[model samples]
Target: MMKVMAFVGSPRKGGNTSKIVNSICTGLKENGHAVEVYYLSELDNVGCKACDSCQANKVEYCAINDKMTTLLPKIADADCIIVGTPVYMLQLSGITKNFLDRLFTFYRRSNHTARYLPGKKYMTVTCNGAPAEAFGNVTEYLNQLFNGSFKMKNVGNIITGNLTNKDDILKQQGVLEQAEELGRKLS
Candidate 1:
């Protein structure tokens, strides 16, 4: 079974973003893929320091000793990475941005290549109060990061909009089902 790492970037517990992520994880588990979910809002993760330490390979990991350091190995070991976020100001949430920044360790400045992360499968789930078309650029940005910069395979993306309340997503039909289907297809 493939290992899948899922990150929830919303601060609200039981929010729309987490519901989508949890649905995807449920599908991954049903497909017999090992799945681990991390709530970025609750983690002590920090932004990239840009110290060039990981680039130089001076330390075996990111120099920052935050919670993200512990998650680095899990990220490296996973066969797929799932990122879920709530759109904020036409972009990803702050915590999600910080979490992405911390992934700099995977980039080797020496060769200008991503280390231990290339060729991995990647997916994203984004929920916004605005219409889905309003944030196509956000989705494109994520796609470019995973498929272009990181050299990862773009498996799928679930972009849902008009979800303001924590339970609004549940009221929408087929969105969560689509997320589950996306997860199952990943396997």
Candidate 2:
């Protein structure tokens, strides 16, 4: 069974994005894969300082000691990484964007032959206040970030539309089901 790390990037706890990710995790767990969910909003994650510390002293280690630093080992070891976020300002939520920025550590590491992570898969879930088509830009950004930057295999993406209210997404049973299926297929 593959170990998966699911990151919920919405700032609202138990919000639409988190609910969908939890469902995905449930499916992965049922399929005998190990899954761990990390809520970015709950973590004290600082944006990447662009310091070359990770590249210099420690080897694959970011110097920042915030909660995000705790994720480096887990992210490196996980076979699959799943990220879910709400669409804000036609892009991923600030929390997710910050988390993505922090991933510069991985990007820098991969630039040299000493890539810490390789052959891993990634999934994305985006919930928007508008229709799914309206948030295609957000999905494309995530796809490019995860695949182009990290070289992770793009497994799939689940987008939920019209999710202004956090609980509004509960009405989209199909989207949640799709997320569950996406998790089941990850490994």
Highest TM-score scorer: 1
| Full-model lDDT for every candidate | 0.89, 0.82
Cα lDDT of model 2 by residue, 113-173, tens digit = 3254557888899988888888888888888777776677888888778888879878988
Distance from true position, residue 86, model 2, in Å? 0.5
lDDT of 1 by residue, 19-90 (tens): 999999988988999999999988877688888898888898789888899899989889999999999998
Best by lDDT: 1
Q: lDDT score, residue 40, model 1? A: 98
Q: Give Cα distance to truth, residue 3, candidate 2, Å.
A: 0.7
Worst 10 residues of 1 by lDDT: 131-140
Q: What is the lDDT of candidate 2?
A: 0.82
How big is the RMSD of model 2? Answer: 1.8
